[model samples]
Target chain A: MIIAVASGKGGTGKTTVAVNLARSLAGPVHLFDCDVEEPNANLFLHGAVERTDEVTLPVPAVDAAKCNGCNECGRLCQYHAIASFGSQALVFSELCHGCGGCMLVCPRGAITETPRRIGVLETARSGDITIVTGRIDVGVAFAPPLIRAVKGRIGSGVTAILDAPPGTSCPVIATVTGADAVILVTEPTPFGLHDLTLAVETVRELGVPFGVVVNRVGMGDGRVHAYCAKEGIPVLLDIPDDRRIAEAYSSGRLLVEALPEYRTLFTGLWQAVGELAAKKGRATEVAR
Target chain B: MKIACTTTGNGLQSPVDPRFGRAQRLIIVDTDTDAFTVVDNAAGAAAAQGAGIQAAEAVVRAGAVALISGHIGPKAFRALRASGVKMYTTDAPTVEEAVKRFKAGSLTEAKSADVNGHW
Candidate 1:
């Protein structure tokens, strides 16, 4: 069963829940850090890198020699990545979405795809817990392609926890698309509640079964809880605002490892997630 | 010499648009004939990305030798430079005023992009 941990607001404990849940689970679990822009789960896990693979996107490359500038490729390119007025087509490689529509529309067959390295995937093992981190190279604007690359490494028949990027944008959608269940982490603050509403809408629109995990509780008001109750959404678990957790997280330590007491909390959270997924019939066979 | 001015409306008296990539309309004025034509730029304004590149292409295709705008992004700057089109910045309120400033050499030619992309 695959579960994606996501939050609309940054620093809302999606990674904390994802990594801790992956570590606390009893059986073999894979944690895929789909936040390719910046993968920080590895920092907390400190797992040794087992393998590294480069990720590439197939961007179009034009051949000027084939010679008739019909401008069909230019018209077909929605991104304006390729434009031809009366001469050879000008290709803006960075702007290309790699849709291959231009290549298909080219009557002269002058356009071909070439791989452009965008990011790298690192597979690491921390004891029985396997962590796959997708790290995009600096200045890479798009993250969905790299996020898809990370999800492609999902281990079969094992519980996979995807630590999604923040916001309800394309990257978050890419991460939470096919999950058995999604854990929307949030704090109790006004900012958290506002973004959480958007995140809830996003998941609901995608038709994915999701539950909320309120982090840093005891600081903000109970509006989040009230909102969830009114919407009939389950509040899976709540992690209180403790300075100790913050200090441990700051020093690159997992919460469950730093305070073994929290292992029970994460494990219980996992169990609740399994039950939630099972109730939704998303993971009947794999919910444990 | 023909020059393109980013504007809010179709007429020469229309206010000059501050944005280059998402300008509402482009007014192409012929210095020799004192005649002009308007090109609607709604497509570039609505583009998700590469709006500047597309706008630049449109200006080039309209046979403009120079561009007058409040700001130019790096991508558009490079594109216009490659096409041998000179870019100048104008604080003039209207397209006709901007053309007058361009003819009087009161406007500064941009050596590099004045603003970052998506600004």
Candidate 2:
């Protein structure tokens, strides 16, 4: 079972819920931090580095010697990463999406793909739990490609928990696309409610089964709960506003580790997720 | 020598657009003959990414050796620089005024991108 923890707005406790859940779950559980822009799950789940891999994208390099300026590559390229103006083609590798469309359309066969390093992926082991983290190099504009690289490390038959990046953009979509169930983490504030609506729409559009985990529940208004109730969305867990939890988070401590009493709460969350996923799986099977 | 000025309208009297990559239109002027033609930049203006690069290519395609605009972004500057096109920053109100300033060497040559990428 794959469970992706996501939030539409930043600073909504996605990493908090994801790390704690990974710690509470029994058996083999792999946690993949798909937030390549700024991965922070390793700060809480420190482990021995087992493997490292560099992430790269294939960007085009043009050869001027064999070139006739046909302008076909420029017209075909939507991003305008490469263009020819009655002369040699100009290639801006940073703007390239690695689609290879230009190479295919190049009649002179002058364009060749070259690997450009974009980020790094690391696999670390914390006790029995495996943590895979991806961090994109600075000035790299996109994150979905790197996020996909992180998701590639998932081992089969292991319960996987993905810590997704914030916002309902391409990065978030890339993280949550294949999950069995997604945990939409949000606080009870107005901002949370607004972005939760967007996230709910995103998950619904993707036809994925999801539930809400209200973090810092006591501080904000009840509109989040009310919105969930009106939409028939399940509220799986409610973590109250507690200074001890904040302090634990500040010191890079997992909630289950810092406050052993809350282990049951997270364990129960896993149970609820399992039941919901199982039910949805059966429903999908029946539909198919 | 041909010069391209990012503009908001089609004619010489049109105000010079502050943006380089996402400018509304580009007015190319032949400094020798005083003849000018307007090139619509709707495609670059609506581009999701690399608008500056596309706009710079458009200017190069028009055979403009120099560009006059309010602010040039890094990517646009790189693209223009690769084509050996000089970029100039202008505070002139109209396209005609910008061209006059360019001809008189009153406009400041942009040694580097005045603004960061994605501006």
Candidate 3:
């Protein structure tokens, strides 16, 4: 089963829930950090990076010699990254989405795709748990491709927990698209509630089975719980505001490792996730 | 010489558009013929990135020899400069006035882009 931990707002404890769940789960489990923009799960994991791979995107390189002043590529480009200027086709690599449509439509065979380094994928192991992360090179805007690259390392037969980027944007969608279940981590604050509504809508639109894990629960209003109850959304787990937890997080310690007392909490959360996913699977099976 | 002025409409009385990349329309006028053609630049206005470059492409494709706008970005400047197109910054209210100033040599010559990209 693949469980993606996501949050609409930043600093809402997505990585916290994902890492702890991975540690608490029994049997073979892999952790894939799909937040290519700012991957921090490795900082709290007990592992040295064993393998490194470069991530690249295919950007177009135009040959002016073999070109007629055809404007097809520029017209077909959705991002407007390609522009045909007289005899030259100007391609801005940063703006390219790597769709390769520009090269395919070039009638003169003048457009060739060249690889540009956008990020790196690193793999590390902490005992039985394997951790993979995508780290985008600073100043690169394209992250969904790299996020997809990191998720490609998922091995079958092992539970994969994906730590998705914050918000319900393209990157988050890419991460949570195929998950068996999604855990939306949220605080109970007003901002968290507002963004959680958006995140919930995204997951609902993607047709994924999801439940809420309310962090810093005791500190805020009960509106989140009330909202969840009203919508009949499952509240999977509630982590209270604790200074010890904060200190553990600040010191880059995994919750399962730093506080053995909370192991049962996460382990129980996994059980809840299994039940939720199983229920959804049966529902889909029955419908089909 | 053909001159391109960023404008809100197709005619000479159209208001000068302040933005080069996101300009609504560009009026390419031939000083010799006193004739003009309109090129829609709204595609650049809606572009996610490299709007300036795309807008520059539009003017270049129109065979414009000079460009008049309130502001030009670095990428647009580089693209126009590569085509040897003269750029002038103008506060003229209308496309007609901008073209008149271009001929009178009163508009400031934009030797470099006056603003950063996405400005």
State the C-alpha lDDT per candidate: 0.90, 0.91, 0.90
Q: What is the Cα-based lDDT of residue A164 in candidate 2?
A: 96
Which prediction has more favorable DockQ, 1 or 3? 3
Q: DockQ of candidates 1 onward, in order? A: 0.42, 0.52, 0.43
Off by over 4 Å in 3: B7-19, B23-43, B61-63, B81-84, B89-101, B104-115
Tens digits of lDDT, candidate 2, A153-189: 8878779999999999899999999899999999999
Compute the lDDT of residue A37 as modeled in candidate 3: 96
Pick the winner on TM-score between candidates 1 and 3. Answer: 3
Per-residue lDDT for A150-226 in model 1, tens only? 99998678889999999999999999998888999999999999999999999999877889999999989999999
- Interface RMSD for candidates 1 onward, in order: 2.4, 2.3, 1.9
User: lDDT (0-100) at residue A198 of candidate 3?
Assistant: 96
TM-score of 2: 0.92
Better of 1 and 2 by lDDT: 2
Candidate 1, B4-119: lDDT as tens digits: 99999988899999999899999999998889999998988998778898899899999999999989998788778867889998889999999999998898999999998864
Candidate 2 docks with a DockQ of: 0.52
Candidate 1 stretches with Cα past 4 Å from truth are A282-288, B7-19, B22-24, B40-48, B68-74, B77-119
DockQ of 3: 0.43
Per-residue lDDT of model 3, residues A1-288, tens digit only: 899999999999999999899888777689999999999998898678999999999999989897675869988998767766654777778888999999999998999999999999999999778999999999888789999999888877778999999999999999999899999999999998999999999999999899999999888899999999999999999998988999999999998888898899998999999987887788789999
Q: Which candidate comes out best when scored by DockQ? A: 2
